[model samples]
Target: MKVCSVSVDLDPISCYYGIHGLGEPPAPLAHVVLQRALPRFAEIFQRRGIHATFFVVGSDLASDPSGRATLTDLAKSGHELGNHTHHHRYDFARLSAEEIEREVADAHQVIAQAQGSPPIGFRAPGYDMSARVLRVLESQGYQYDSSLFSSWPYYFAKAGVMGVMSLLGRRSHSVLGDPRALTAPVDPYRPGSGPFRRGQSSLVELPIAVSPFLRLPVIGNWLLVAPARVRTRLLESVRSRSFFNLELHGADLLDADQDGIPTQLISKQHDLRIPLKDKQRAFEAMLDRIAQDYRFAPLREVATDVQREGKLRAGGQNL
Candidate 1:
């Protein structure tokens, strides 16, 4: 079966601020994503019958009533709310193990409070995680982690972006992760011993999708900015894989003009510069294409199914 998993990193504008290396965005940008764009994302998934997994920053729910309410509504409407850490720390790789544990625990507590259940999955901020991070997840009883993006093309592009920003005097707060990720497996595997090498940690790693041919990404930010021909070809190539683990962000749907975001800030984001209507059409079309060719499931569900497949293969059953 061709399985598909859709997810959104519901990072607040503060997270984006870190990416842009800016001090802080206007207050409106903070609430706009959770309070404004979330419902719209939910509606799109609902209409298309796609069960999206939302990786929410735990700290975002700490004191905001409206934000918590909107997240709670997502749970009520059957979306799987996963943890994206408490602070959305960009330097998650550099944090001490104790701090990492605290980050995960704090986020877990807050998310569990809102959804009435602890999230079973996690995605590291900035797609940077380490062995210590995976250990904390195992200790916390998480079923899976989806932070390893091993596409060489994606890595080079990210490096170039940060490099350009550095030269332009706009030092981005985003950290380039472990270079070894470029060699990690592109499919689901266990991350017990290390994030890059397969081990016995009991936690599955569902890497984001990349084209098998050239490692072109199938992520939302790339999709929104990529040309139509490139997007179509990449999607088709990814569909050839057994699992299509598509990742997105709340900012992917927000428009610079209507969202009240700082022009300077959003200008750095390629996708946000596109007209909101055009973004919607492109996104919907992409989803429609996936819905036609693959069965859309949340990461939690897809992870479970992948686990089963692994077990069956170990049992000598041909997949």
Candidate 2:
């Protein structure tokens, strides 16, 4: 049977501040996501009877009681809460091995404390992963990593945007990871000794879903606001893959007015500009199509299913 996985990265507003190069605003922005957006997400998933995965940032959990409680509630409701590094650093790929280890371990403890168990899955901050990063995960006995996004179109476009941001004198808090990541597998694999190449390793890699043609990302960050025609074309390309992963961010469900998000922030973020109701409808439409076409499950369960298939890690122990 064809399989699908849906997951979200619950990075708080501070991460966005870094991404936009806003550089620590004088006053903190209320985590619009924690207060409203996440509740909306919980409602949608609960109504749909979907047990999705959520990658949680460590420090974010430490920030507020409400956010922590919300995340704990998600775990209690049967959704998988996975690891996102402690600081949500955009340059995770550039961090030293010791720092990487600290990041993963710190987040693991924080999440485990909130959820009553340590996470088996991880997604790197900013979708950045490298051989060193995987080694850190392996050391911690993580079962899977879903940060490898091998999409040239997405990568190059990001580079271009960052370049323009630099030229315009805005300090984009993001960085372009190794260009080699674009060559990573379009499907899940057991990352061997190499970063992208398949091989024997205790840790598995479930890359972010990308359209095989032109390597466009098939995730909510792009599709939730993409025109129907564009989304339709992208969906067609991804249907051919055996395992499809749809990744979303906590910011996807926030609105400028209802969520009290700054108008300037909304203006700069393309996806956030869409009306919340419209975005919900678009997401539901896509989810309807996905449910019709494939059997869906939480990402950790999906990875377990993949490992059970005996397709990856030849002669390599099942992850």
Candidate 3:
């Protein structure tokens, strides 16, 4: 079984950098990572003989020509390039259908211009999405969306509905009121037949990997917050799962001492103050471990593989 699929969310906005405690606008740390850390990340992956997807923000491509060139280089280096969003907006759940379409379309255009092809995969900022968001993604020609995580692979719909409801504060005894509620598979499962069919839609949903601990999602951010021994146990637990989807941010690998934002946001999630060197060391350690046990693939490749396998199991033509 594949134990992990590594992905990076590259959000380049000053607000994102600030909120994450990387720095204020024109985050110097962010620029450094784009220029320095990303190349190192690519080198690490290449040395390990693995490839991971990079979900880039459209605005980042527009604002930073060098960053765009670097992404194109990554693609040339055999890594997958994907779209995060144009503005990296957090309120996708509140946006209207038309608005969602425009945002996705605009981002698609920018990514295509930079990479010389439209992105085949997308990840909504904050994993915030709605049914309309899915509709637009499918219509806009995205092949996969990695924005939702299901605790259990087999019973993902029910589990994801419960998890999403709790997060959105719309949980009720009688009905699932979360606007993001949909019966799409929570892992790398195929959509239904037809354009609007829940299971047969053209797009595949590849949610982040969550651990089975207390039925909660176990992802990278959570791993960062866990104690050393506990994190070890969680990683062991992840190796036992059917599939492991690990995520990282470009900023996560950068040092705080670098010219950039303040230290509050980086330290916000954890009580202990993690210095830049330590952060880089921790990330390198995680990459080393993943390199040993997993065969990393881009999100689009994974989804396509899953779809083909599912079809084979059902005695249907390969997708």
What does the lDDT read for residue 150 in candidate 3? 43
Model 2: per-residue Cα lDDT at residue 281:
88
Q: How many clashes show up per model? A: 1, 0, 12
Query: lDDT (0-100) at residue 97 of candidate 3?
Result: 84
Writing each residue's lDDT as its tens digit, candidate 3 over 128-191 gives 5566777788888887888764444324544465577568765322222243323334345554
Ranking by TM-score: 1, 2, 3
lDDT of each: 0.84, 0.82, 0.64
TM-score of 3: 0.78
Stretches of candidate 1 above 4 Å error? 308-319
Global fold similarity of model 1 (TM-score): 0.94
> What is candidate 1's lDDT per residue for 125-177, written digit by digit as tens?
98998988988999999998999988888788889999998998987889999
What TM-score goes with each of the models?
0.94, 0.94, 0.78
List the candidates ranked by lDDT, beginning with the highest.
1, 2, 3
Q: Any idea what lDDT model 3 has? A: 0.64
- RMSD (Cα, Å) for all candidates, in order, is 2.3, 2.7, 6.5
lDDT of 2 by residue, 1-319 (tens): 6777889898887777777877663354645566677888888888888888989888877776788899899999898999999988988878999999998999999899999888999998888888899888888988888998888988888998899989999998788888778887777788887668889878778888888768888889798767899998888888776678889998898876776677667667888778899988888888888888776678788666556775432222233
